[model samples]
Target: MQIALTGKLAKAMGVELEPVNDEQNPLFTWTANWTTVWDNRRAEDLLVLVNHATRFTVAVYQVKRKDLKGMPEMIKQAIANTLLYMNINPEIVEEYMSLCGDVTFTRNSNRKAAAWVTRAGLDTSVYIGHEYNGIAKMFRDTVGASINYGLVNYSGKFDDGFMPYEKMVTALTELTGKQAYKYRAFELMVTLDLDVYQAERRIIVPAGLEFTRLHEVLQSVFGWRNYHLYDFTFFDEKSERTTVLTEPLDEYWPGDEEIVLIEGRVLADFMPEHGTMVYTYDLGDNWEHEIELLRVIENYDQESPYLLEASGQTPPEDVGGVGGFVEFREIMLNPDHPDYETMKEWARFWSPELQDWEMRPRAIRV
Candidate 1:
């Protein structure tokens, strides 16, 4: 692996730069921005590393001027953290480095690191003064946001709409025969726990998705407006209890049980074992969904999760739970009934797709 460092970092490290051939080996470049803080008592530097092939900001680190001496170990740890953030096994760090070749120090020739580091610095500037989340979390969030927005959303800067994340994953999969951390795709069966209606949605999502993004995928596939609170309950086999993950809110929970925040938690962390997890939405309406992981799809090509199949129309929001849904369905079945037109109009208000009075479910990508 070739790691190119800026002249300042090279000078700080007391390393002599040697000219090398531009081979096909994987290359990464490092750049930094220094700033003084706390009344100029200490100097802070933002170290940014960019993958030359993918042009992805692979790792980011914040450190003091004195800590630069241990940059060799810091770079390794940062790469491991970035790989973990991408849902890739960090254990392959050494193997990946070996596959790329020996570590060679060189001065950047293409001048690509400056642009990438500048973009990273601008994208992460808002988190510089954040009270709770430090630079590590900020880097994780930046990486996730970039992947979701650029790769999954197909909004990359390339003219041909190339995705850097996909390219990197494909390269790694080819290099390593075992797909240990290629982001396994899980096929999930989500069924609405209703006594009458048979609403079920089959979805395929990458295991690396965060709970918050998974919530959005559910909302899109089920045609929900995402207007209410929701929580995911997963059974912990070891603890013999259920754990709840939800968005942090200023409300009181009944027990002292630790509630996990869904902000930075990925689905792989609390994957439900052969059993089912409950996704409860809208505390008032109490729409409980039974989510089951059916199987893992091998070699899934999609960047984002989608609805593989759907059946039965979902109930409208604020329909007063299952009883109200039953009553509404009964009225909708009988046009001669007095409240038929009223209920139909109200249902149409919630879902404009009910124009033909028929529920049509189809496959869709979220």
Candidate 2:
């Protein structure tokens, strides 16, 4: 039935009405909520058998929901947990192998509906089932041995398993407690002197920064590359003659401007400096065991560089030689401008006193 008719059906059957239509309206208490077991599973992993087993568990549970909201959520969570314990935990590829498992009934005969868990952009929080299919019948122990046996024998039926969240979660779990699964990140900053049209790596000074811990923060802030690629750039740049105490952009100091940023500490501190155009806190690296990895990336990416001042001895020059240091003494920023870009990007920049690096956000992304 159409949405209007569905509401009318609910009203006519006295199905206990709630805001199931207009999002602003609160929903009634009769929604089916299926709780999905959430683990960051990417599209196309190898946990289909486990996922299928979880689906089978959902089918066999025979759980039914009166409301639409909570029912799917409950089923999703139950199934995910079951899949993890039943198939994923055992490390078997085919579903038939799990016919004999150390399975115990966390939920037996209490559920009466089916919950689908596919990465096809299927409903995430809940799946309001239209009908109970193959997986649904499994909850009731209704899937015969013939059908169960076919799953192990058939290859085409299991292709989607390679692309679902089930396998991703299982694989991630297997990879956990290892460096490959841990948080890995880096930052890149590029500062441009508007007067010279020459850009280099630089970070924000303390006066323009505001963070309790500068090292720990990772953020994305407004930045300047080619002005057309990002937001607007300052036409009025600060001349070298001005006192650095004045805001960098007093006369349009390109490196001294700020940009808008999505809020967060991990992504906030390393956000692009407005005029400087810095990009930091980059996760997922392409190379291992190398300092100034970003500089290498900048050399190859053919993308505009973000301002990264502390990159200690500006990003290695592309002309087969390390560029000479661009000293703060020559610039208006200050003689004491911290080489934060270098320290954050490469540990070699850390001095004896500044070991175990940790910093926080001190500038606005905008």
Candidate 3:
């Protein structure tokens, strides 16, 4: 039974599970057997299994009654408490409830049960002698599904052991028959003064990503700590006007310049294939980065931005600008300079091997 369940889950997750080998139990079959001890003894059964290897869990339960309608408040509270105990986020619980509303339950002599789980959080579970094939099938069909965009970045902190909200929404998109925008992959060449410095990178991201998210990705790719203000400027030939997208800093500078907030605008709203723009970081330093839309990738399956290729290390933060970097480079190269040791220490802090200026193509994961 466990083997069958695992196979179903693997199919949903687009992955394969290999058979386990044991020296002492070499003849053991691949089939999984549910221990009798795990069977429910009480009127209600609630089983929660956490698998840290996959960073997810499996929750299965069976109520005492056959009908789901007019379920007692006590039973609902019990389920809610169990979910809280499992550290599942409230947002995920809400999404599950929303999806559950679409399912039509059929009650029969056999007990009725429902299971909700997904890859990267919940997996799969089966109840004995239960008429929940519909619910189980729904869960299995949407496993391993990718979403257009993530509600929040997964930074390996405060993990709620649930699949991302976007993934859940995507999985339910087809079932709900809701119209959703298809995300397109974009390949861009970002250069910091290609005419002189020649620092550049190749990045691929989804068109659905917000400009703010793109800003964060640029900081990661350029090795910037994001300590200063930045803005994106582009010339719209159709509109025949220069558009500037920047953070809202009304308190700092209440100028007449029309500055569009980057929070809600998506990349595809303004950037098209072969489009070009300029990104200025650190107003004081006036560091300008040239951004060119190289290509548009159709039917790509990735959800997050990736650093495809990078060349020419980024300048150290707060190093006065391009001119400052040039001066610092000269001092570092000349061992006889008065501040050579100090500059060398600073350079080593940013790049341990002093490879800050090395122009080499490399693959980096963000």
lDDT of 2 by residue, 125-145 (tens): 122232222232223221111
Q: Report the candidate with higher lDDT, 2 versus 3.
A: 3
Give the clash count for model 3: 1
Worst 10 residues of 3 by lDDT: 105-114
Q: Give candidate 2's TM-score.
A: 0.17
List runs of model 3 lying over 4 Å from the truth: 1-182, 194-196, 251-257, 352-366
Off by over 4 Å in 1: 5-47, 59-70, 84-94, 100-109, 120-145, 148-159, 174-186, 193-199, 204-229, 234-242, 246-274, 282-287, 295-307, 310-366
The reply for model 2, stretches above 4 Å from the true place, is 1-176, 180-187, 196-219, 223-366
* Candidate 2 structure lDDT: 0.25
Q: What ranking emerges by TM-score with the best candidate at the front?
A: 1, 3, 2
How far residue 69's Cα lies from its native spot in candidate 3, in Å, is 20
Q: Higher-TM-score candidate among 1 and 3? A: 1
Clashes of each: 1, 85, 1
lDDT per residue, candidate 3, 1-366, as tens digits?
011123322333233344332331211111211111123442323223222112123333432233223222322333344333222344444444444332111111111111212222222333222223322311111111221122322446647434533333344344345333234678889999723457788888776666766787788788788788899888877767777888777753546455677767888888683299888989998889998998898755443466777777678888888888878767866889999999888766664222533334332222
